[model samples]
Target: MFNRFWSRFFSSESSDESTTSTKNSKPDDKNSGSETEMTETSNEIDFQLMPTGLKKLLNKVDLSHPPGLAGDICEDLATLEYRALPNLRPAAAMMILSSVARQIENPPYKLNLYVISTALTASGKEAHQNYLKQALMDLGLDSKLHDTPRSDKTIMFDLLYSEGCSIYVLDEGHVLFRTALSSRASTFEKNMADLLLQLKTAKQYRLSGNLKREVQEQLIARLEKADKKKSNTAFQPEDKEKLKNLLELTNECIYDPFVNLISYSVPQNVAFLFSKKEIETGLLGRIIFVRGPSKRAPLRGHDKVVRPSKDISERLKAISTENLPTESLAARTTLHTIKEYLECDENRNHGMYGAIFARGYEQIRVVATLLALESKEIDQSMVIYAFKQFLNSLHECETHLSTQSKTSIEESQKLVELKVREYSERHGSGSFGVIRNNIFKCSAPIRKLENNQKDFLSNTLQKFADLGVLIKVGNNQYLHKSCISAKKLNTAKKQST
Candidate 1:
C-alpha cells in the first residue's frame, strides 16, 4: 500500500532543468567568495558524470525517472557507475567523499565538509574506526586508517604534525558545529577553531616543531582564561575582540582542510534535531540527506524474496557501492535530481509530496542541506521540492492519524450523549446539570453547561423546557411554568366561568 502511495506520489511529475536551478538557491552563502568558486568547480564535474549512472540506475529500479526521460530513453541503459562508489558510505558519506575528490582534482583552495547532525557519541567510535579501515581496504589505498580516540586538543595537535593526512573525517560532525557556536572558550569547538587559525597563520608564527606545541598550549590557555573572565560578567570590549580573534584564527588555520561530514535521516528529523542558528550558519547545508524505505516493511510473499544466488550482505554491499557517488559533484547532482522529482510531484499535490510542500519551515533546512551538498548553489525549484516532499510525508501521517482521532472523537461524543440521556431519564430535569456534571466530570464542554439539554435528553421535562414549558430562575435554576397555573387564582376563576 505504501509502495503504491509512494509511486503515485513520486512518478506523476515533470520537472524542467531550468526550473530546478531557480528554486534551489535561497540560502545566504556566508562563506568567503573563494568557497563559492570551489563549489562551481564541484558542480561542473558532477554534471558531466551524473547522467550515465543516473540513467542506468533509473532503468534498473522500478521507480519512475524524473520527468522528460520517458521509459524509452532509459531502457537501453546498461551499467551506470557513481564515481564515489567504493568510498560512499551513506548519503552523508557520499557528500564528504565527493567534496574531497573535488578538492583533489581541483586544488589551491582547501575544502571543508561540515557533518552536522543532532547528537554524537564516542561509546561506539570503534565501529566507525573499523568501517574506515574496511573502506580504506576496499579502495586499495596504501594507508592505515588510525582509530584516534584522543581529546580535541590532542587531535588538533596530531592533525598539525601529521603529514599527508589531507582528509580529516570528523565522525559525529554535529559536535563540532555545536562547539563552534558555544560561548565557552575552553569548549572543543573554540579550541578546534583556534587550532585552525594557528594552521592558517603558520607562516606568521614561524616556530619550530617543539615550539609549536608551546605556542599552541599558551594560546589555548590564554583563550580559556579570557572565556572564564567573560563568563562572570558581560563580555568586555577586549574579551569580545579576543573571541573574534579566536574565530578568525581558527578559520585561517583550517586553510579549508577538507572537512567532510554527513548524516543519515529524514530532512525534517535533521531540522528538528538541529538549532535554528546552526541552520542559518550553513552547518545544516553541509549535511547530505540519504533516504531509503524503512526495513521494517519488507516486501513479502514474492518470488523475488527467494534466496539469491549471491550472499544478501554481499548484494547489499554491491548495490550500495554501485549506486553511491564517489565525488561531491555526482552526489550533489543525484541529490538535486531526486529532489527535483520529489518537488515536481509535490507541486501538483501528488501523494505525500503535498505534506512536505506545506511544511515551509522544515523545507528550508532540507533545501539548505541539499544546497550545501550541491556546493551552495541550489536552485529554487529544488527547495520547493524539498518542502513539497516534506509536506507530503507530513500530510500522509497527519491524514491517517487525524482520521483515527476524528473517528474516536465522534464515538466518544455519541457515548457521552447516550449517557447524558440515560441519566436524565433516571433522575429528572432539574437534575440535568448535576447528572451531566457527574457523568462528564472532567469534560470541559459538559461542565461548562452551555448547550441546551434537549439535544441529549428525550424525557418530557427536557422536551417541555425546549417548548418553553419551564421558567428559568436565578442561578441557572428552572421551574415548570405549568406548576404556576394551579397556584394562580385568576386562572382557576376563568376555568370555572
Candidate 2:
C-alpha cells in the first residue's frame, strides 16, 4: 500500500524523463530547454501537485525551455555528469543562480534563499549539492562556499574577513532541527528561525559591538610590533594605515549580506524541524522545501565521468561579482505580476496557506532579480521557471508538512488500534495491557510520543469506541467488532470443514 501511494504520487516526476535507463546505474537526466509543458486547466491526476495560483500564473508565461543563464546552468550541470536525480535538477539550478546572485550589489532586494531538502535515508539527497560545490571549486568560484558558521555573531564573519560572498551547507539537517528543540541550544542556532525571516529582505547586518574589542586588541599588538622594530619611534606608515583600516571596519556597517543556506534531511525529521511554532512564526513558510523522489532510483550501469565542454566552461568562468547584469523589463514585469497576485492573497485564495504563498512571492522576485543579473536577457522564462519550482515546494508543504506530517502521532495511533483489535480477538476483551506491554515490537515513532502518553492513548481509544469500531464491555475493557466477527467466521469455517 505504501509502495502504491509512492508510485501514484511521483508518477509524473519520471514521466517527463526519457526511458533510456538500465538496472544498477545512477539516475537519468534527459530533460532539455524544450517543454514538458503544463497548462492552467490541466489536472493531470487526482493528486495534482501544483498550487492553483502558480498554475494560473503559468498560463501567462511560456513553459518551454528555461531562457537565459538559469537554462544554460541546467544543461551545464548535466554535461558535468551531475545528471538530474528525482528532485535534484531544479535545486542545482537554484544553487547556480544563487552563487552568481550573491556577487551582485543587492540594493533593491536581497537574493538570498533558504533551501530545505527532504528525502529517504541514504537516498543521496546531497548528491547535487556536492556536485555543484565540486564544480564551483574546479571553476575558482569556491570562495563563496563554506560549511556552517561557528556562532551567530560570526554568521557572516568569514565573508566580512574575506572579499567574496557566502553559501553555507548543512549536510546533517536532521541534527540541526533536533538541536533547535533542545533548551540548551546555542544562541545562534536558536536564532536560526528569526535570522531566516529577517535576512530574506534585510539590507544590512548590525555589526556586533563586541567585535570591536578584538579589533582594538589586534591593532594594539600591531603597533607594539612596529614600535619594537624602531625602539622609541612611532609605528611605520604601513602599520599605521593597517591599524587605522582595521579599527574603521569594526565600525562599518555590513550592507547586503548575501548569504544562502542549504540543508538535506530525511522525511522523519520534518516534525522536529518545522513543528507548530515554526509554521506559525513564518519560518517554515520562508524555507523552499525540495522533496526528492518517492521511490529509489532505477539501478543502471555505472558510467565514467567526462570533462565539461569548453562552451560550458567559458560560460561558468564568465560569472563574477565584478559587475551586475541589467534587470530585464519582461522579468521585472513578471515579478510584479507575481507580487500583485500573491500580495494580500487577493486571488490566490490559499486560506491559511496564503501567508506561505506570499512569502514565496518574495522568493520568486529575488530569483528573477538574480537571473536577470546573471543572464542579462530580457525574458520572462526564468521568472516563469522559478514559479514552476516554487509551485512544487508549495505542494510539498501542503501534502507533507500540513496533513499527515506528524508520523510519530500517526504511528502511535495505528499501533494502538492494531493491538486493541488483536487482543480482543484472542481474549474476547479490551485492556490497556495489550498496547502498554507490547513495547517489544515497538518502533521509534511509538517511543517519541508526547509526555502524556497514557492520556493520549485513552483519548484515542475512546474516539474509536464512539465510532462503533470498539464497544465498551466493562470498567476498563472493550470489544473490537471486526476482530470478533473474524474470530466467529474462523470458527464456522472450522466446523464446516
Candidate 3:
C-alpha cells in the first residue's frame, strides 16, 4: 500500500511538471541585462568538476538530472508562476523537515536551515515567498508557519511550548539584520539575536523577561480555542497544568525547541548592514543566502489559477513522518561524507562564503531531512542533492553580491541625516518614529527605503541625538541640536570671502 501510494505521488509530480512547465516557464533571455550577466557568471562555475564530497554525491545521483524531493518542489513552485533560485525548493522543504524534526531527539543541534533570500524589487521575491507559503499550506502544514516574529522572546516561548513543529517566515529579514547592527539597538533586538543563536544549537533555552502583553494574549487565545474544541481538542487537564508550569517557568526556562526560520530581504544596501565584526563572529555565518533570479521572468496575466501538482497533497497524506534514529550508523556515515567537503580549501575561499561554509554540517542536517522524508538510509545521492542545493544557493549569492550596487555606507548615512534635518526644520520637532518614517518616504535621490532602511534610520537618529545633532526631549521624540546648518555655514563663508 505504501509503495503504491508513493508511486502515484511521484507520477503526479512528474505529470504536473511535464504538463505545466512551458506555461509558467522562465522567459528565454538571450539579451536581457541581468540575464546575460547571470548567464556569464553561472558559466564560470564548473558543475562537472567535483569540489566537495557533496558535489560528488550529487553527480553520482544525477548521471543525467537532479531528482528527489527538492526537484519535485522546484518543479511545482515553477509551475505556480514563481521564478526563484533552486534554494527555494529546499527552503520550502523546511516545513516538511520540521515535521520530521519532532520525532528525532537529542541531536548535537536542532534542525535549523537558516535561509536569507535577496532579490531586486518586483523580481518575484514576493512571488517566491508566496510559493513557499503555499507549498506548506498544500502539505496541510499552514498552522506550523508564522509571520515575521514580533519579538525574540516570543520566538523563545513559542518554540518551547508551541504544539508540533514550527517554522517562522520573516519577510523583511533585513530589518532584523539592521536592528542587530544598530548602534543603539533596543535590548529586545540584542536578546532576540542571542536567543536565536542559542536555539540554533542547544535543545533547551532559558526564557527570561517578564511575560509581556503579547504572551498573555497568545495564552488566552490558546485557552479559548481549547475550550471551544473541548470535545476533540488535545488540551487535557495535564496540558493545562503544563501551560501553568510553562508560565511560571518563564523565569526558569523550557526545553527542546525544534524550530527553523525562512527569511527574505531586498538586496539593496544589505551588505552595508553587516560589519566585519558581525561577519567574523558567526552571526552572519549562520545564515544561508540564496539569490533570486537575476532577471525576472516577465509577468503574464492569466485568467486561470496556477497551482502545484496534486502529488504534493497526495504525498503529505500518504507518507509516514516517522523520524529515523539520529544515532544509527547510516547517520554517522552521512556525517563522515560531509566532513570531507568541510575540509576542502576550494570550498573555503569562495567570496563571502564564510556564511555558507561556516555550517559544514548543515549539509548533513539537510540530508538527514531528506532521509527522514524518504524513510531511507543516508546515501551518496541524498548528500549530493543536499550539496547541489547549497552550491546553487552559494553561487547565486556570489553572483548577486558581486553585481549588487555598491553604495558607500557613509554617503548613504549623510544623505539620510540631511533629509532628517530638513524634515525637522520644516515640521519642527517629531518623534523618532515620525522622523524615520518621513525619511523613508523620500522620492528624490533618497527614494523609498526598505523596512530595514527605515529601521537603520531609527537607529541612526538615536546615535545622532547622542552626538548632539538631535536632542531627545521625550520618549521616542527628538529635536535638531542647536548647530549651524552646513548649508548656512557654506553660504556665510561665501559672503565673507
Q: Which numbered prediction scores highest in lDDT against the true structure? A: 2
Clashes of each: 39, 8, 1
Best model number under TM-score: 2
The parts of candidate 3 lying over 4 Å away from their true place are 1-66, 82-87, 98-100, 107-109, 138-140, 209-245, 248-253, 273-275, 303-308, 325-338, 344-358, 392-497
Better of 2 and 3 by TM-score: 2
Model 3 residue 323 distance off true place after TM-score fit, in angstroms: 3.8
lDDT per residue for candidate 3 within 316-416, as digits (tens), equals 55555444433346546655655555546644544345545656566556545554555445544555555555554454444444444233446667887
RMSD of each: 18.4, 8.5, 13.5
Taken over the whole model, the C-alpha lDDT of each candidate is: 0.35, 0.57, 0.55
Mind giving the per-residue lDDT tens digits that candidate 1 earns over 178-281? 45446864554455544443442132233335434554665677667767776566657676565455434543433333223333223233333233233333
Flag the better candidate by lDDT, 1 or 3: 3
Please identify which of the two predictions, 1 or 2, would achieve the higher TM-score against the true structure: 2
- Candidates arranged by TM-score, highest first: 2, 3, 1
How would you encode candidate 2's per-residue C-alpha lDDT over 1-497 as one tens digit per residue? 22232233233434433342222123443212111223222212222333454455564432223456655555554433322343554565666666656666644556677888776566545555666676566677677777665444445445554442667677866565565456788766665445546665668765555445654566567667776777445656765666566556667766776667778776667645545456567777777887665555543334534343466557766776665555468767766766665554342444346556657776776666566655565356777767766665666564554344445567677787776777676677646555444432454444455343556655777777666566655566667767556666455335434
